[model samples]
Every structure is written in C-alpha cells, then in structure tokens.
Target: MNSRYLTPLTIMSLAWLSACTPTRVSNQVSIDSPAQWQHAANAQSAETADLKTWWQGFNDPLLNELIDKALAANHDLKIATARVREANAMVTGAEAALYPSLDFSLSGGREKRIDRIVGVPSGQGIKLITPTADAVSGGLAARWEIDLFGGRHLEAEAAAAQAEGSQEGLHAAQVGLLAQVATNYLELRGVQQRTGILQRNIELQRERLRTLQVFLKAGLANEADMVRQQTLLQSTEATLPVLTNAKQNLIHRLGVLLGEPPENLENRLAGVGPLPKATPTMPNLLPSDLLVQRPDLRLAQSEVSAAAASLGSARADLYPKLVVSASGGVGALAVGGFPSLAESVYALGSGLSAPIFNAGRIRAHIAAADARLDQVAANYELTFLLALEDVENAFVAHRSARDRFSQLTEAEGSAEKAYRLVDAMYQRGAGDYLVVLDAQRSKLAVSDERAKAETAVSVAMVSLYRAFGGGWTIHSGIDKASIR
Candidate 1:
C-alpha cells in the first residue's frame, strides 16, 4: 500500500490490467423510426400482427400446413442452421486461443556402429564406448500468450459477435422461407380459380354454339353465329393450358421449397382450393419494433460489433506481446545389454515480442480494421433505413391491394348481374346476341381481375410480415445457449 514501494513490474501489471480487458459489445443500436405507417387508410385493425404464424390468420389449413413443412424442411434454412453451428465453433476456437495450450510429443532413435580399425577382436569397438545404443524421450509442453493488450480477448469478442450474427441470419432465413411458401401457395390458388372461371365460360359458349347450330338448321340464325361461338370456346380453352402450366410451375416450386422432388405432388394436389383471404385487420408495429423484429437489422448490427472488436484487436497488435512456455521430459540411453541412468530435463521461459520496424505492416492492418469498422457502421445504418422503408412499402402495397380487391369484387358482381339480364333479354329476342356476348366478356374479365386482386392482397400481406421480420420457429428459443 506504500506509494514509495511501487516497482516497475507493478506499474506494468497495472497497465496490463487496464489495457487487456475487452470492451463490451452493445447488442442494440438506436435508429430513427416513424411512429405510424405511411399508408394506414384501409387497415382494418391497428393490432400488431402475430408474425410467428401470420399465415394462419388466412383461415386456410393447407396454407398453415405448407408453412410448417417449409420451416422444417427448407434447404436454405438448413444451410443457415449449419452456418450458425460453424460460427459457434469459430467462437469457441477463438476463445481457446486466449488460454494456455498443452501439447504432447515423443521421440526415439536407435543406431549401431562397428569399429573398422585392426584390433584383437574385429567385432569389438572402443573399450570405453558402446557399439549400439537406443534413446527415447517424451514430454508435455505448454505455451501461453498473456493478453497484455487485449488482442486475444478482442479476437474472441469478434468471433462471438459473428456467431450472434449467424444466429440472426438463421432467423432471417426462416422469415424469408415462410413468406415465400405462403405467397407461392396463394398465387397457385388464384391461378386455379381463374382457370375454373375460364372453363365455366367455355362451357357456356359451347352450349350457345350448339343452340346456334340448331337455329341455323331451322333457318333462324346464320352459320356465322355458330362459328363465332366456336371461336370463343376455342380461345377460352386455349387459356386453360396457360393456367395449368402456371399451376404446375407453382407446385414444382412449392415442392422444392418443402425439400421434395418437383413431380412429387402431382397426384396430391389435383384439385384447386380457394385462394387465401387476407386478414381484415393486422397489428401495426412501431418503428423501433422493427429493430428487434427484423433479423437482418439485428445481423447487421452484429456485424458492426464484430468489426469494432476486430479494430480493437488490430490496435492491440501495435503493443508488445508476452509468451510463456514450459516443457519437461525424462529420457534413457540404452547400450547393448546395458542401460544408463534416466535423466530428467525441464525448461521454462518467458519472452516478449515488440514490433520494432515492420515497414508499416501493423499500421496498415490497423487502418484496414478501422476502415472495416466504418464500413459496417455505414452498413448498419443502411440496413436500419432499409428496414423502415420495407415496412412502409409493404404497408402501402397491402392497403392498396385490399382496396383494389374490394373494388374488383364489386365490379365483378355488377358485371355478373348485367350478364344475367342480357342473357334473359336475348332469350326473349329483346336484346341482340352481340349485347349478350359483350356482357359475357365483361363478366369474365372482371372475374379474372378479381382473382388476381385477391392474390395480390394475400401476397402483400406476406410481404408485410416479412418486412416486419416476423418468423417464429421452435428453434428461436429465448435461451442464449440455445442460439449458440
């Protein structure tokens, strides 16, 4: 406790104590976010979404099942999981470098020699020496570098941050995979519905063609009417193949998403199901909610932490390093039919390596690390801004799509009523055949638009969920050890 008794070694130890402790990495960063969404006009509910199973809100059991399957079997998710494991391994290895390492080694040698000088006995060597000998040795060695400047600690810190980033990456992948599966499934259903609508119209036209043919035979209608009806039927039939092809592609894509072969679902999904309905109200989230919810943003922030730790490590390189090493072993030399006493050997040493003149290599490394930190900082900010933009964009798209779907549905209903009235008038000879055909066309077009609009509404909802970084897998346990 006496100040006068402080030694140079004590002062150096104090310096090491201050310098070797790694600075902590912040797990969260601050970003400016809007309090409310840009397009909130048509939103039915202000409630926050249940992002973990947002697809279930559509009330489609099949959709929910598909999302579950994708989460379990998706190849991209598997890859992300593997990366997380790899990062975890790296973290452990980096940390291990901060502690002492022990190694084992063994060596043995045997040799025989005969004296060629003329003597009383040809096989005899020098009288005082052995003609053959064998020696053996083994030992445990240890080496430790004292982290006087926090170099090893910072390396471990950087690796730890990277591991956390990989965990976030895995979550990000889950979010993307679920959203993709849901969107593709919705589009497939939409296409199927459109195909059904076209088929119904084609059948109606075929029946009209038959009636027109009878009228021509009875000399009441011209052959031109039957030909026109036939042409309409053929054109409508032609569109069926396109829709079928699109459906097939979607099925194949979905199969791949679920980690199955493309043709694996050909027999199972033969029938079309109704397109998923959008939830009437979705929970709105705050801007700050995105920072915690969006895995990409979290991953980006982790990258910043890693880069900062790396800079710390690089700066530490400019300081001196202390290495402690020790080794000990026992060995015996054996002569022909005899043995020498075993000798014990041991060594312990401590050394310091200070960067004297390295042609600015260490400085360059420090500069590079600084640049990397700056890059990641910029990237983190970019990611935050992009996340906000994503939410706003998805909100606008979702609202607009809902609006469009509503308008299209109303238009389709009106067109269908008009078609029915025109058909009745035509049957009574009060309206021209042209009027009926025109009304039929209008109804078909409106119906097709309505189906597409429905698909858009659902897809936009998926986008909104994805933008919010809302994906919950059983693997996303709250335990930090689980993530590692």
Candidate 2:
C-alpha cells in the first residue's frame, strides 16, 4: 500500500479499536431481600408466582361492584393510565433515534434590488434597472447519527426500561387503590355495626329506666337508682350521633373512591349489611414472591436498570460520533412555470466528531448516572425489605385478631347468660336492682367488645391480602387489557 494511504488506514483502525474498548459495565443488583421470618431453607426454595384475585373470596356483591366502578372511573387511576401512555410514547421517541431522520421543506420568495451611482452628478448618473426574481425550492434532507459507540442503543435501552418502570408504577397504583377501597369499605361496615350495637343498647337502657321508674313508684327502688338509670340511658343515646357521623364520613369516602357523589351511593347502599366474614385461609407464599407480584418493587428494579443504561449512554458521549447526511431537491427560478426551467441538485456527505473539551459536563453526566443507579439499587433493596416486613406484620395481625375474635365471642356469650340469670333473680325479688344494673352493663360491654373484635379480624384480613400482594382483578378491567 502507498505510505499515505497506509497511515490513514492505521489511524482509522486504531479509532475503531478504541470505540470497541469497554468503557463501563452495569452494576445493577437484584432487589429481592429475604423476609425476617423466612428461614434459610425456605429462602433458597422461594420463587414468585402469578398474582391472584384475592378480593373475590369475600363474596360481597356490593364490594365487587364498587371496585369495578372505581377501576373504571377513579381519577387517580385515570392519571396512572395516562402516565403509562406517556411512557410508551417516550419509548417510541427514543427508538426513533436509532434510524435516520428525514425532513421535507419548501420555500418561495421574490426580491428586487435598486442600483444608483455614487459620487456622480444627479443628471449624469444613469438609473440602473434591476429585475425582480422569484425563487422556489423544495427538498428532502436526511441525517443519521451512526451508533458507533452504542450511544443510541444505550439511550433506547434506557427508554425501554423507563417504559417498563412506568407500567409497573401503574400496577402499583392499582394495588394501592384496591387496598384503599377495601380499607374504607371495612371501616364503613365496622362503623355501621357499632351504630347498631349502640342503638340496641340505648333501647335496653330506656327499658331499664322505665322499669326503675315503676319500681320507685311502687316503693321497690329509691330515687337515686332511677336517676342513675336515666343518666345511663341518656349517655347511650348520645353515642348514636357520633357513630352516625363516622358512618356517613366513611360512605362519603367510598363515594369518592367510586368516582361518584355521596348522595348517589346512599340509595345503592341503603340495604347493605355489615362487613363480610373472614377471608378464607389461602396458602401463604414465600417472601421472594414480592419480586414478581409487588409492582412497586418491580418499578424500583426497572429504575435501576434504566439508570445503568443511562450511565452507558453518558459514557458513550466521551468518545467520537459518526454521522451521515444527504439532501436531494428540485427547484425553479422562473415565475409562472410548472415543470419548465426546473433543475435537480443532490449531495451526500459523512462526518466524525469527538468531544475534545466541554468544561467537564460529560464526566459529570456519567457520574450523575452512576450515582442514580446506586440510589435506585438502594431504593430497591429498601422496598424489598419493607415488603417483607409488611407481609410478616400482616400475618401476625391476622392470626392475633382471629384468636381474639374467638375468645371475645365466647366471653360475650358467657356474659349474656350471666346477665339473664341475674335479671330473673332481681325480677323475682330475690336480688337487688343494683345486681340487675351491673349485669346489664356487663352484657353491653361484652357485646361491644365482641363487635369490635369481629371488625378487627376483617380489617386484619384486608391488610394481609394487601401485604401479600393479593386482590385486584388485573385481567377483568379494561385498562389492564388495553394498557399494552
């Protein structure tokens, strides 16, 4: 080969080799962390499985209907769906950079120039006539940045990761909505049950007050006892308003969750009964299951992946870039001419550019990306740990509440029997009025405690389902199906 050509080829080969050199490797770490309760043996064998629709187990038609409506019309859900669409569009935009960009342009204009002689007599100066000319031009231009160092590829990869992250975020939003709706519904039912209990106790107190008044009239009980009974009845009556207010508040919250006004739901739920019974005991999976089913965790993981890709893209900027450009056009300068006097012009060219200096901006970007990846990795780990904590805490709560409900039920029954026996004795003149009063109070206390215990059990089950990443029918809804 000639010396000059050989030198140029050697330099080109060196540049190619430099471009091939590895600049950075991804340091993304897995997000899965073992639960505190999970044993080593179980951890090793753990694997994520498909998520199930756990809420259907409740078998409440009203709850099912509300959840369906919320999924369709809730404002927050609409926002999340819109975010997913925006992310998908961003992915498309990033992928577009991998190909050539072609643009078309057209222009038409006329210009006239007047010429006058300088430093000449006004009369002697000849007036120069200039003709107006019209120019019309149209062209197609193309430019492509050759991905010589994987910059465009890295950018596309980062964008794809972000899109996936957004999808996971949407799922997380759905899960949160499911949990909120369940919590609000359970609270509403609990309040209703409490109100019913209060009403029944108030009626019993009123009856006791009447009985005391009759005894005082018949010289069987004193005025102090009658007054005490009257006070108790009034106190019990006072509780109803507070309970009613709480119940109404919960209904309003549910209305918002369902994307409707409270008045609209009042009629629909007028006959709705107490909260459903306990959720069935489903098989509990291992903690590692969060990696697949917990959308927030997956979103964090995707963020880490995106950060790693971004680092790669930033590092690619440290090296040289290659670009190819081309333009083709047909133009005419003649006015009122269609295809006549038209001329064609075309050109093709290539260029190479390297970042020589930019006040350390490129290095800072690469470092920022690296830091972001680290931050995402840490966040992922934290999310995994938090998920594990949630599952174990929910499990403990469910078990504790379940046992408490059983014990309270037994206690309430015993109290009811004792109260009945005491009441009969007092009615037969074998016991004092104080005994009847104490027994009745005991019965009311036991009943209230039992009702509260039942509510706790239901709420705990909801928490367990949420912590276990269950509930929410992912496939039945329109957004779930049309999102992709």
Candidate 3:
C-alpha cells in the first residue's frame, strides 16, 4: 500500500471518529418520595410484618396451599419467565459482538476437456487429446468489527437492562397471581358463610311456620298469615342457588389459576370453611419504599435505562465502522501428465466504512431512539404516581372494610336477638306474623352484609400487599428483614 494514498484517508477517518465519540445517555427521572404514608393511622401497630409472607398471617393452611400451587403452575408466570430467559440470551448475543468470529472451509474440484491437434508428428493428422485437471483448497478466515465508538457496548448495556426489566415483569406476574388466588379464595369462603346464615334463617322460619299452622288449627291465625310465612321461607330458599352458583364459579377460577381443570377442585373445596381472619395490621411503610419493592416501578425504571442505552447505540450509527479480516490457507493443483503444484495462501486486510448518504435513514433512527427514551422516562414517572395511588387507595379500602365489618358484626348480633324475641312473643300470641317477618329479614340481611364485609377486609389486605409488591423475592436474594 502507498503511504501517500492511505495517509489522507486515515486522517479523515480519525477526524470523523473523533467527532463520533459515543456518549452515555442518562435515564434518571425526578420523583419526589413522601417520608410517611398518608394512611399511617390505619396501621397503628408498628410491628414489622414480612410483606413477603403476609398471607401467612391469615393462618389458613388451605389458603397458603392454594397460593403455592398457583405460583408453581400459573401460565402467565411461565410466560414471564420465558421472556426473562430470552432477554438474557439477547444480552449474551449483544456482548458477543464485542469479540471476533472465525470460520473454516474446504473445497475440491476436477475438470476434463477434449481438444484436436492441428499439427501432429510422424504424419499423424488431427489427433484428439483429452486433458484433466484437479484442484483442492482449504482456509481459515476471521473477521472483527472493532468497537471504536463503543456502539456494541451500548447495545449490550441495553440488552442487560431489558433482561432486568423482564425479571421484574416476572415478579410482577407472581405478585398479581398470588393476589388473585387469595382474593378468589376469600370470596368463596364469604359466600359459604352467607349461605350458612341463610340456612339457619330458613330453619327458624320453618319452625315459625309450624307454630302458625298450629295457631290456624286453634282459630288464632288465618290462611293469609300462613301464606306470608311460606313466601318468606321460599324467598330465603331462592337465594341459596345464587350463592351456590357463585361459589362454584369461584372454585372453577381458582382451579384454573392453579393450572388444573375447572372442575378439579370441586371435591377439595366443596366443604364450607370459615373465612380467613383479618388482622388489619401493617408495618410502617413510606412512599420511597415503593421504588425498591414495587416490581412495576422497577420494571419501568429498567425500561428507561434500556431506552437510554438504545439511544446511545443508535447514535453510534452516525459514526464510521472499522472491520479487520484475515485468511490463511493451502491450495494444490495438477494438470494431465504434469506434476502437482501446491502453494500456501494467506491474506490480511482492513476497511473503514463511514455513512455518507442514506436518505436520512440514520438520522431518523437516532430521532426514533431519542423519542423512545423520552417515552420511557415519562412512563417511569407515571408508574411511580400510579404506585402512590394504589398504595393510598389500598390503605383507605382496607381500613374502611375493617370498620364496616365491625359495625355489621354488632348489627347482626342485635338483629338475631330481636328475631328471637319477636318469635317468642308471636308464639305466645302477643305479636303478629308481620313483626316476626321483619325481624327475620333484618337478621339475614345483617348477617350477609357482615360476611361480605369480612371478605372485603381480606381482599383489601391482598390488594395492599400486591401494591407493595410483596409476593416476590429477587432471584439474587433479597434482604427480608429490610423489606419488612
């Protein structure tokens, strides 16, 4: 190579490279964290509860078992896990760009040709001759595209960040799945409790109907009274089917969540059980904790990082690329009636390619990457705001549910007492059927409300823990004591 011809081109390439030095794109977003939660009053007890195992506080073995089954088998969680693995593989591929690649090849061929001899010795005229040739070749070639502007490194960084985001996505899926299973389970138990209340009310109403028949035989009660009592009993009976259907639906949903057929758990969960008890207790938590605990927020943060790195990688496209390649091999060839000839072949070369004109394609890509960076940053901020909303709403909902349940409990007891007293009076011919019916209706209504309220409290707690991102631990291991 002539120095004179290469000197100017090398200088120009260096100048371009100097101007294209890759810069790091920052993905940091501004977020103000509150020092304390707004609904701190709802959680008066300061005892640190391990949010990771918060469901254990319910003290229901069946509930814990269901959650375990869902975690092990849920389809959504498996999908998230696969995504994480894919992202990790992408990271590996991107990093591989930082190194060189080598390849080996071998080839062989034979050719034959027939020719007529125009001039022949010893008066031999137009003699025909056949000629054949053989060739063999083999080589090893290597190529490397040097990361002069750190473009490949940026790509690897982006891939790593995406892998992290996918991991957080898996965690988010786990958290949501656990919450769903717990919510449905609590609802199922609540329906069962309400059903039991209706059954008891029916029994009481049937006894009153028997007393009325006795009164009618003695000329104290009329056919209209008997008809009214029968109507109340039938109305209570009608409600049972609705509750039965609801319970069955919930069981089906739970079974699917656990990766089983819809009807698989019917026998297992058919027996009625008491609803999980609510403690209404939570550890002291601050808004800042969400940054570390909440998977969605973490996922958003990772997205911002990935977007920023992608922007940097795209910007590297504006610069020049340098590729170096080398090949070494041996070749052998032989002609008909001639000795074989063999030679060693080798080559070393390098090239520099700078983007000159592509109809603004590179610039468009850079602009798109910049736009994505901005989008992810904004999404990160929005995610934090939504996390705050979720926590605040869960706090209020859990507290309100607990309060409503307490009030309903007292009302149910009073209604039951009233119903018993009115029934006693009517049996003694001191009260009418209307009074008994009113008391019976009130008792059933209050009892049902209390059961639903109790379930609400449990479900609210589930929502609160989910908002806190409690059900998942980092694959690298998390500090359980600190996260509590």
Candidate 4:
C-alpha cells in the first residue's frame, strides 16, 4: 500500500519515523491574590454599584444623557466593536478549514489548424484530420485536508479567544470613557461654583467700597482707604474670567465626548450647575473580585488563552499534513465534417506532506508561539497587579478626599458665621469696614476650597467605579461566552 493510505493509528505507532511533540495542552495557569482589600476602611457599607447605569447614582439628568450619547456614538468604541465582528469572522474561517471545499469550472475553445498525420486507421484507409475543431469541457473538483492532529480545531479555539478579548477591550474602553466624562462634568460644575463665589465676593467688596466712600465724606476714612477697597473689589473680579474660560473649555471637551461639534453643546450646558453630590460608599469591592470586575484583566487573560491555543496549533505543525482531492468532468470535441464523441473523465488523489528537514523552521515556529504564550502570561500577571493597585489607590485617595471635604465644609460654615457677625457689627457702627472685608474674603476662600474638595471626591468615586470594571453587558451576539 502507498504510504498515503496509512491510518492515523499506524502513523502514531510509527513515531520513530518523525518528531512528534506532546499533543496535550494544559489550561492551568496560576495567579495568587489576597482574600480581601487592605484599603476598605471608609468603604464599610454593603451597597453595591448599580451595574445597569452606575452614573445614575449621581442623579444628574444631563450627565445621564451625555453618557448615553457617548456609548451610542463614540467613534473609538464603534471601531472596537468592529474589531469584535472581525474576530468573529476569523473564527468562522478557522472552522471552515475542517470541512471539504468544492469548486467548478467550464471551458470552450476552437482550434483552426490541423497538423499532418501519419497514422493509419484500423482496418481502413487513413482518415483525414479536421481543419477546425470545437472543444468543450466542464469539471467539478473537491478537496479536503484531514486534520489528523486537531490543528484546525485549536486554531478555531484561538480565534474564539481573540473574539472574547476584543469584547473585554470594548468594555474597558466604555469604562474609561465613562470615567473621563464624569471627571470633566464634575470639574465644569466645580469651576462654575467657584466663579459664582468670586462674583458674589466681588459684589460684597463693592458694597464695602461704597461704605468706605461715605466714611471718607464723613471725615472717618482716608483716600488710601477708598483706593484700597477699590483695588480689592477689582482684584476679586479679575478671577471670574479665568474660571469662566476653564468652564467653557470643559464644556467643549464634553461636547466632543458626546460625538458632537464643540459649538453644539454651549447652549445646553451654558447654565451653571452644582457639583455632583457624593453618594454612599459602593459595597462588595474586594481584592479577589478584581479578577472578574476588571475588564482589562479579563482581556489580558483571554489573550493568554488565545496564545496557548495558538501554541498548540503551531505544535501540530510538526506532524504530517494529509489532503484528499478529487475531480470529475465531461468533455466533447466536434469537427465540422465529422461526428464527434463525448467522453467522461475522472481523477482521484491523496497527498501526505511532512517537513522532513527545513533547517528547523517548524521547530522555530513552535518556539515562537511558545514565546508568545509566555509573553501574554506575564502580561496577565502584570494586569492583575495593576488592577489591585488601581482599586487600592482609588480607595485611599477617595477616603482621604472625603475626610478632607468634611473638614473644609465645617470650616466654611464657621467662616460664613463670622462674615455675618462682622457685617452686622459694621451696620451698627461697631466694626470697621476693613474687618468686614477680611471676613468676606475668608468665607469666599473656604467656600471655594470646599467646592473643589467636593468635586475631588466625586472624581475619586468615578475612578473607583472604573477600576471595578462594571459590565456594560451589551452583547453583540457573538460575545455570549463568558471569558474563561
């Protein structure tokens, strides 16, 4: 029998004929993690993040609209979604490699010249060859490569892993985009609040200037005092334009985030709004949960899986490749002065190819694939470490900001009380206008700090939510399988 007719059992039994790598691929890779988070001090609450629109906890309707628009229209996210579709197609193509392929062809041609012939006809005079001949032929061919080592199946698995990784990458992008939007929105609000504080303080300083002018007229104030109050009033007014410019720039950033032109969102967000109020602590965040909650980590792990399956596919290349092909056709030749006969033709074949020697090229391929697996495994481990660091940093920073905000809020209240008392004393002629002016400045400074601290806490919370990799769960249909 021809060597091509050898069955897989015979081939494996004759392993001394060629090199064979181990066919078994293990799915085991270890990552050690802690049981609980170390920075869960202020986050003692049991409230979990609302997986279905985590931003809604802010209770800002415009924020909700912006997030919805970003998810629907963000161009980077749309490109990531397209990558997922491409991965899905690759999986289908890999699966197609396991099945037989059929193709068809047809041809017709005319030949005008006939060469001199010397052969005699059987039991008759020599027959004259035709000067013009018409020929027609049609054929059907089928080919199949028998995957004796499951290489094609492993390639399909790798494609599926790539598809899963693409999905996690999309989710991570959504998480990042949400975090950016939240940060910009809260900052815009904070700048507006500070600008408002400055405007109000400017008005108070102007009133004090008016009072100073009356004092000068009554021989109780000097020219220096009137000029001093005027200077303070104008100085306080100077900061508003800078703050207003920053706020408008933040609005433009938000407009682009929502996939709109910069000029389109000014009217809608023109009115100043208060900063987002900090909500109760999100619950159920632990170190071990980061493995599942972080989409970037999930993507890294999926990439590792793909690399492993691809390594298996490359290893399979060390063995023989077997292919079977067959073709069948009908042909007819017609001469202008003679009858012609139609004939049936057929052919069958099988091919077995093994890399006998190629200067270790196949081995190099397997080595390269194994190296990729190692690279992805390292990346997966680093991603886990980064995930832990992100959650811990967010927790500590948020708790510190929350605590600091509380202290500044108390200070703001005290400062406001002092300002009111000084104003009352000035009205009854018991306090100097300079004293009232100093008290007002103190109050404004504390109020601005408090607003900034509030915005910081809000932004910190957004960072924590982003670290927790809350699922968007928007299935593009092909991403049904959970990441392994």
Clashing pairs in 2: none
Return the top candidate by TM-score. 4
Clashing pairs in 3: none
Clashes of 1: 3
Q: Can you write out model 2's per-residue Cα lDDT over 105-172, one digit (the tens) per residue?
A: 89988876555222323586854445556788999999877677777777888898898888877778
TM-score of each candidate?
Answer: 0.85, 0.85, 0.87, 0.87
Best candidate according to lDDT: 3
Candidate 4 lDDT over 259-303, as tens digits, reads 889788888878878876645346466565566667787788788
Error of 1 at 445 (Å): 2.7
The lDDT of model 2 is 0.75
lDDT of 4: 0.80
Which lDDT values do the candidates have, in the order given? 0.79, 0.75, 0.83, 0.80
**Residue 286 error for model 4, in Å?**
2.1
Worst 10 residues of 3 by lDDT: 475-484
lDDT of 1 by residue, 1-484 (tens): 6755554465457446735455333333445656566665433323333667777788888777777888888899999999999999999999998778999989989877666222233456534443567889999899878788788888998999899899999988888898888888888989989988888778767767877888799898898777878887898789888999999999999999999897777776658788865463465677666666778977887888898888888888878877878999888887665557589889877788999999999899988988888788888778878887887899889879989999999999999899999999989999877578678877988898999999999889889888987766333322122111
Residue-level lDDT tens digits of model 3 in 179-225? 89998999999998988988887887887788889999999899998
In model 1, the Cα lDDT at residue 367 comes to 89
